[model samples]
Target: MASPILPGSGLGSGLDIGAIVTALVNADKSAKQTQIDAATKTNTLKISGVGSLKSALTAFQTAMNNLGNKTNPAFAGFTATSSKTDILTATSDSTAVAGNYSVVVNKLATGSKIASASFAGGAASAIPSGTLKISQNGTDYNVDIPANATLQTTRDAINKAQGANGISANIVTDSTGASRLVISSSKTGAGSDLSVSGIAGLEIDGTQLMGSSPAAGASGAVNGVAQNAELTIDGLAVTSKSNTVTGAVSGLTLNLVTVSPGTPPTPAIVGVEANTKGLQTSVQAFVDAYNTLKNTIDTLSKATPDEDGKLTVQAAFTGDALPRSMIADIRAQLTAPGAGGPLAVLSQLGVMTDRLTGNLTFDTAAFNKTMAQPGMTGQVQQLFTGTNDTNGLLARMSKAVDPYLKPMDSKSKGLLDQRLDSLIANTKTLTNQQLALDLRVANLTKTLTAKYNAMDLLVGQMKATANNITSFFASLNAQQSAK
Candidate 1:
């Protein structure tokens, strides 16, 4: 027997049946694989589905990053309203006015009788609270006691004080909505607080003092009149109960306590986490498909085999032709090295699959770092491009399979056209051959039939002759017996 070709090697072996069988098997397998690969490329299984998914994820991620780094003042919430004058102004300190203004009414009058009073020392409490009146110029004023007032009743009674006094007290609510009576001088300057005289039942800590200064143990009552408390604002004397002065400057709020407003407006919070979440979902899908393809490759490329020496693959996947090529395409893209390439190599991105376990683990921090680097995005595109597209993974694969696919170059000899020409020119060749075969079959059938018919006729004639002979012999035997 002639030498047989080895299956995998595709070379003839000196009729070694085993070698020949192996060669045939391997050759058939290789050819089948090539055909499968060609089909896969034409179908665009790996490129269209997985590649598009990854590209979309990458695009979204880039968008998110760009949004994150954007800085625009309009994005920060800032709205301000002012009354006529600019909220902020810059004037030389030396050229400002020195004079101060004040407001005072003459005919100060009060109610016939004082009801009650309170003087909150340093704390705000509802004890020792009452009502009183103050008569300034010709206007009569009744002071309402706040819920949280103390022995400051003498100060409260000053509401009933009648004279050329230049101070007035009123109750106002704070930002927290707490009511507190405030006492302020009609005059803003050195002597803005009260100077009690005509009013009785008034004293600052029990000692008599007339000016804008607070007196220790000022207390007293004269004809049901109360004393006054003193306070200062910006070196100008102004007084109030539970003072919570705000809006010291336009567009700015200031709590009377000990604090200054912080500078600039705090940036408004915006939600971009939704976009990141979407990107993550897309990326995860890419990861899953990639892993599936990787698993297919691992199964086909496994060194270990079963007792039948066949690779272990899912039952349906066994002998499936698509997986190996898919893996090769992926592996080629991931491992291919180029200067400043999207990843340089898969190892840089922690995308290398474990040889032993067939598992793909990632170093997220490393991957992120790489992505953040300059030119990383372009490199990433290159890695996914493979060899298929001018820029894709399948480009290389297509080139390799070029020999198996359509002809690389058309024949210049016009063989195809010539073949058609020959068929047209010799149309009778096929007819003649077909006619000859038909006539030969017909003649063979006729000859066989005629011979069989002639034999049947001969056998009939012989049988008739033998029957006659037998009848004659029987007659003769009977005559002899009679004689």
Candidate 2:
């Protein structure tokens, strides 16, 4: 919105011809320019508003999802603590219940690590042409030994072969310049240890020691025999071939680190308890996230009036149905009953909504009292994470925001994408129209300047002619007067 008289090139008639042309062009362009400007402002506001809504909704869904994870479920998780972490450690998932146990780790399971006597000829010791047969847990893998195969090559062959899944081999050379082929099995269980044979110089007894390479009986034990994990939970015996024990105590996993045997037996006290504080924190975070989304919607779609009921201030989406409709759709989901449990609805778990603001508020004290009841911890968790059907409050809320979560550049347009695309196209069209109008104005200015300059030239020629005629008349009159 500018003044009608604008600055332009004015060289021809001193009647301010430039100003006149500018005024004419302004008069032609003003109304359309104003319309375009207003439309652009409104569309830009809508784009910004929708983009903000999308971001807020996406973040809310993320916070909600973090609480709904199955493994580390929000307030219902049972934390497992081991008193003697040096002897043993414990971990529990959502399936674990609160309980105390006296665990005694008898001995740690040891894996078989066997070594060959020695290769006095170092890593270059040659072997006989026979298959190096390696067996573990009734499964056998064979490595073809070519004639004149060196000790290092056989170890490399065993390490690289496909069928040798858990068999490891290496040449360990002592300071005496003697290399011994040390091989170990990844298997830790009692009857699952690796057994190797079928080659002459590389035949090493997995249980004992013997002579060296080219001696026919070169074998020895590096870390001795394999054993199973022996431990007791609550005085009940539990034997595992591996040190890491699972399924022995329902949902608990016990990792036997070392021996804690004898006198009072050095027992490990493991305790599983409900994480009530974690549950409370998660609920508060969920409520806060939802409230943030609600606030954004309220601010963007706000249409407030003065005391006289006259709207003096306007917002981005004021009087627009889009924001209102979106909030209504999202709000309607909270009323639907959650997928089955003792805690049937969100309000039962203290997630309540305000009557006026439509924002959620969590009643921590009330929730804590309800959770304090016997066997209500897991029941309360089921409210947000539905059983059999994933139609819980969080699930429904996530679904509501899914439409707006898509990136703007995505081809599969989101809720706000179509409107944004339309606005952008409209803005471009308006720009083109403005450019066309400017071109026309420039052309008109040039035409008007040329016409005014032509008229000025004609006026100047007439004045010159009149002056010449006047001079001639004066000369004639003077000559006559003199006669």
Candidate 3:
């Protein structure tokens, strides 16, 4: 709230003009300064809330990352070559030797064509030969019939229609000179259904022609044209579709080069360990953020106050007690001893406490040493991962922050991420308000100084005038006495 000054409050003090103006200007300045101060305080609280939340999140992420590395055995003693891909070969011998080995196939070229297909069995009796319609994947194609259109011509038409569906079709003549039409699906799926329709003389796989009808054709004939490659990973049979097989896992790719029956193929491994490193880094980032937030809250809450009982007007915070309350709630959640929690209590984790500050002080040397223990990670994981206990520290922290972290949770904003967003927004608003108020105060101060200066000048003039009159009267009195 700003103070509003009226004209008559000892404003000019007899030399009314300058003095009154100065008083008015000073009052306005003070009011503006007050508003600016209030706005700044509000902003500070908003920033504090956001900063604290971010720090907590970072910490949680860091803890999770550390635990992940510690718990995942695959990451232990894992190393990668320069290319980050491992190409290991396995050769079979007449004498079978049993050892740990996984097959990897590196060369498989896959192309599916209508395998040994014929239209109405290439017989004139079945097709009757006018115009035939072939439909694939629910799209219709028209084929023109000439006076003497051969089965090859119809096959060629089907091949030409391949471009419509982004599928390639071609006619291949076998060694016996038997011509076959292959209608390949552009993509594989049950949805890639093919059918024959609107044909006066055409049959596909002994099915009569109808108008764009899927059911009119033989079952499994229209959609049955597909190829599959089978490979094994870690002795487990895995079947996959695409030629380039990087889609299998985060850091694995399987390229099928050959199909040799009864022989296990060589496998290629790529960049799996590198991916783990990325995850580790991500987790550490979270920890770093968490620590930052924790530090910020601790600093603000514990800062000593001004001796005046009232914070300085320029101080940027409000409710001297709110930060402490929030910190306590957060700390309680973090320090709660438990199994299946974010952390297994501060003390159990080797984090010491300072009695006077009531803060958890980390002994980096001791924590590092303890973490070196063989089962340290396992112990940490047990606390955080299982649902065996509902008192998990992560869960508890989540619960505590939930109120402030959701979007649309509160009319102001919810917690999960919304609280931070709201805080930032509030901070901006506070900054603008404070800046405006500061500018107004500056203007008011200048106006007041000018007015006061003018008033002082006028006062000096009045005193000089009074002195001159007194001297003139004294001179006249002396002259009269002489006469």
What is the per-residue lDDT of model 2 for residues 362-476, given as tens digits with 9 covering 90 to 100? 9988888888876566665566665643676677778777666665564577767766787788878878877776677677667766676677667767777998999999999
Clashing pairs in 2: 209-220, 211-218
- Candidate 2 global CA lDDT score: 0.75
Better of 1 and 2 by lDDT: 2
Q: List candidate 3 segments past 4 Å from native.
A: 1-17, 20-101, 105-264, 267-289, 304-405, 409-412, 415-483
Please give the TM-score that candidate 1 achieves against the real structure.
0.26
Note each model's CA RMSD in angstroms.
29.2, 6.2, 12.3
Per-residue lDDT of 152 in model 3: 66
What lDDT would candidate 1 get against the real structure?
0.37
Model 1 residue 108 CA deviation in Å: 74
| 1-483 per-residue lDDT for model 3 (tens digits) | 342342333232344543465556567667656766766666666566556655565565445445434224221212222121333322211112222334554334343333333344442212335655656545666666555656666566666755665655455454444444455555543334445545542344312222233322222243234445555656566555554454443323344445533344434443322122332333344334445655665655444557886764322223455445555666676656665433355555555656875545555555455555544443443444333434544455555554544454335554435555655777677678766766675566556656665666676787778889999999999999999
Task: Name the candidate, 1 or 3, with the larger TM-score value.
Answer: 3
What does the lDDT read for residue 198 in candidate 2?
Answer: 91
Query: Candidate 1 at 146: error in angstroms?
Result: 99
